[model samples]
Target: MSAEKITAEKRTEFGKGAARRIRREHKIPAVVYGHGAEPLHVILPGHATMMALKNHGYNALLELSLDGETHLALTKQVQIDPIKRVIEHVDFVAVVRGEKVTVEVPIIVVGEAKPGTLVVTEASSIQLEAEATHVPEQIEVSVEGAVAGTLITAADLPLPQDVSLLVDPATLIVNVTEQVSAAALEADLEQAEVEAGIEKDAPETEAAADSE
Candidate 1:
């Protein structure tokens, strides 16, 4: 992965009002801190930053140009509006080339399991320590021809060179089990409804009332 170049302007104002004003101007409030350096407050172009992050994953390495100086940083956190789903604020951490950083990489299941078997994923993502600039976008687990009772753990995952898993080796990632029949699933749902004291409506009773 390559670092995306984003121009940032130093921010002078602080507070909710200032942040709202910045957003109104189609910018996002951000702070950069790492390497024992003081936090730097800045504003980034909202559309450009969102597009860059969408192209790259959350851990995107960014080349931030501020005051004619460029610094390498990693996206640490992004705050978004829950209702509007708009980017609100972002936190970045300064990192140097070849530095290793621990981050969560999404898990992607590939291939189909054996007939009559169902693949269940226990973990959707895993933690890994990798070079800050070369963090993987996702990890893939193959279930091709996997039979029932087959299990995959973190240690069984194939990783790129220099990348190390930070999760427990025994952690279960995927489990292949016999597929449950539709009738069995329905029976389980009925049992759960009974345990919760939920009663199904009787169509005959409704018909009787209609006749009255």
Candidate 2:
């Protein structure tokens, strides 16, 4: 993963009002901290940061040019508005080359399960300890021709060179099960309704007969 060059300005202002003012100017307030160094509060170009993150994923490597010094950092977290989905604040962790960092990589399932079998994913992402500069964007799991009763666990996942799993080897990742038939699905729905004390409406003729 190549680092993106982004320029940042040191920010002395604090509080919500200051943050809102920064956002209004198309900049994002961010803090960089790690390696026993004091947290550096700064402002980053909003558009450039968004574009870099979109191209590089959440664990993006950034070359932050602050003042006259350059700092290597990794994106640790981002706060976004739930309604607008726009980034509000960012947390950056300074890192050095050749260091290992723990991160969660997304799990992607590829191909299809065996006919009449359904593939259910139990884990959406896996925890890994990988080189900070070489963290994988995602991991792929192939389920092609997997039959019912097949189980793929964390230990079974393939890892990139130098990457190690941080999760338990016995943790379940994917499970293959027999697909439920339409009749079976309907029966299950009916059973759930009965358990909930919901009664099916009678036909008009049956209601009239009962009235009589």
Candidate 3:
């Protein structure tokens, strides 16, 4: 991953009041911690951080400059307000060169399955261990002309040399199945109703014979 350079200021104050003051000045409160080091609390430029995170996603590497000292950090977690959808707090974890980290990479399907086949994604993302710097933006799964009953498992996907799947080999990621029509759905519903009638009458008939 490429490091996105951003300027940060050390936060001296704490709590709601301090956070509000920082935000009012168009800044965001953030913390960076990793490698057993003490967590560094800092204020980041709201607009710049927002833009970088919006484009690069949660796994982005940010080159944070706090009081002229630069550090490489990963965007670990972001807390957002439920109603307003504004970021409340952010957590960054420091990463060293060649360090491996497990992350959920988004699954993307390329090309269309066979004409009559419907692609069912059993998993939206796959977990993998990759170098911090080489972490892929996303994993692409090709379904080009895949026919019905075709399955794409975790083991079927291609990975970079440094990346390894952490998910089970037997895990089903995608399945191409024949699409069903409305008539088929109606027929199944009718069959289910007939079976339900048989089940519902057996006990009633036995009770009537006992009464006779």
Q: What Cα-based lDDT does every candidate model obtain?
A: 0.93, 0.93, 0.88
Rank by lDDT, highest first.
2, 1, 3
On residues 119-175, what C-alpha lDDT tens digit does candidate 2 reach at each position? 999999999999988998888999999999999999999899999999899999999
Candidate 1 off by > 4 Å: 186-212
Top model number, TM-score: 2
How would you encode candidate 1's per-residue C-alpha lDDT over 36-101 as one tens digit per residue? 999989999999999988988868888999999998889989999999899999999999999999
Cα deviation at 27, candidate 1, in Å, is 0.9
Q: If scored against the real structure, what TM-score would every candidate get? A: 0.86, 0.90, 0.87
Clashing pairs in 1: none
Which one wins by TM-score: 1 or 2? 2
True-structure lDDT of candidate 1:
0.93
Task: Give per-candidate clash totals.
Answer: 0, 0, 1
Error of 3 at 115 (Å): 1.3
Give the higher-lDDT candidate: 1 or 3: 1
Q: In candidate 2, which residue pairs get closer than 3 Å at backbone N, Cα or C atoms, i.e. clash?
A: none
lDDT of model 2, residue 121: 99
